[model samples]
Target: MTIKAVRGKRDGPTLFVSAAIHGDEINGVEIVRRLLQHRALRSLRGTLVAIPIVNVHGFLNNSRYLPDGRDLNRSFPGSPKSSLAGRVAHSFFNNVVAQCEYGIDLHTGARHRGNLPQIRADLQDERTREMAEAFGAPVLLHAKTRDGSLREVASDQNIPILLYEAGEALRFDEVAIRVGVSGIINVMRQIGMLPPSRVKKPRRQPMVTDQSYWVRARVSGVLRALVPLGAFVKKGAILAVVSDPIGDTSGDTEICAQDEGIVIGRTYLPLVYEGDALFHIAKYKADIDEVLRHYHEFREEFEPDAYDPANHDPSEYDEDPPIAS
Candidate 1:
């Protein structure tokens, strides 16, 4: 419930960046931390309100739900008279989200799963689509807002919002973190909260898709994945093989893709049960080679080794102590 507001010397739009609605998704926490330390804020035009942890109860226990066993995310625009999760959701939505003109909710894959860096938003809206493209993640998913979720409520208020999904729950992926930080800055620039970048680079045209489905394990066993995240696959291609953990090869089953698409998400843990989601495939009508080309360029642009604090403008450096992981 801690909120940090950084106001610029001039007036502009107010953008709120939130993380960890699920508590266990800690990657967004780091993204928000690094974003606050960015020197670019020195010349910022408007306001940046950062909420690093939204579910304090779940965060404390390393769980995804409140003590009442309720998901805070599904309790949006809640009532004070409702349950614990609803009350917290009410307070945060009204006091924080209600005041922002734009929002970016950060998240990660659920427990034991990993997601490629991607932007999920209602791309049908022109403003939201612009913001999503500006963020420049490898993939852009045209996701419909779920009922009772923050994005749905925010959209109802006419406040454009973007949801970023990456990495995995409770673990940090350096690439995902870096991409998150840079993507936020890109959105700020796009929305006129920050100046345009001086260094001209290739603009990111993320692969866009509205169709996706999960490839699930056919049998309960240990999984050996044959493909990595961002990998392209044809219809009926082998994505993984599930074998008996007790060394019974007779029951091995090869999980195959249901459609031609890219691997956007998958389970990281080898142990899985029957019908467990193994690979999240997003189908794209664009040429596969072109999609992959953009993906590679996105990776090259945000590679960790390419960034050095000392190489940045002196004003970009902040004295804030690093957050403990």
Candidate 2:
């Protein structure tokens, strides 16, 4: 594989965990690295293929798409001779990924954005949904699978892949890292690839959303956000407003809400052009209030400050004399 991969021992199943398919989405990259160094893997039952980075070119450039202006994640099952990104994707699919029975592709929002560590997958696929639940990120999105994605290609091969979205590109958020790491470990346990789950679960299952849309800026200016990730809002509530940097233009135009939902994701950068996506609101059926409550409680419970692997000396995990390829 063009990308670097680390494999573990055991005979149960092969599970693939990949990150940085979108170069700027570094949260997953770190998650995969930390996962590999996790002490729990000492007792892992199946082979765990951890690819900390899938799109090296874009990762180096700190951009989301490939150098050829293609999104690597969308160029899956790619041709070996297509392009730099394509070759990388092709090699990964034919090698590391093809060996897996279950997979979790981690990701984060692009520049200036943040997501609440949610699992977006095809709920109609029973196995896919089960893995999502096993992943155990606070919110689960029952999204329709998109085209040209690793998720799509893996599904074709009968491998269940759950896409975990969190944090932001280029910048790592502590909360995002903790949730993602715990979630992936949870998935491994659920698939019989790992012995047991260390992640604590809620009394009820996750809230799944069928569709989600972005709330954009109403005017070009600086933004003062009133609602953060996982906050609940009613129809017509003032989520945020576009204010002129010069404090002009009707004293800041308010961006009124168009629907009642929870903020699954939001942009971190305050400055915006008039139509830039500022908030991602996913609609749900029942338990609207319950969703928000669960999100915050879970987030607090997994405070990123307490789990710094660096301080904990993660390298202690690389002890097997570096297994051969």
Every candidate's CA RMSD: 3.3, 4.9
- What lDDT score goes with residue 229 in model 2? 82
Off by over 4 Å in 2: 1-9, 197-204, 249-251, 305-325
Per-residue lDDT over 1-325 for candidate 2, one digit per residue giving the tens place of the 0 to 100 score: 2344444576778888888888889988778767877887877886777788788888888888888899887788889888876787788888877888888888998888888889998888998888888777878888766777898888899988899998878887777887888788777777786676556555445778787788888677888898988777788889987887886767778986788877888887778887898889887658766766777678677663334434555565443221111
**Best of the candidates, lDDT:** 1
* TM-score per candidate: 0.93, 0.88
lDDT of each: 0.91, 0.79
Per-residue lDDT of candidate 1, residues 183-230 (tens digit)? 999999999999999999778568899989999888888999999999
Cα miss at 322, model 2 (Å)?
A: 26
- Could you say which candidate leads in TM-score? 1
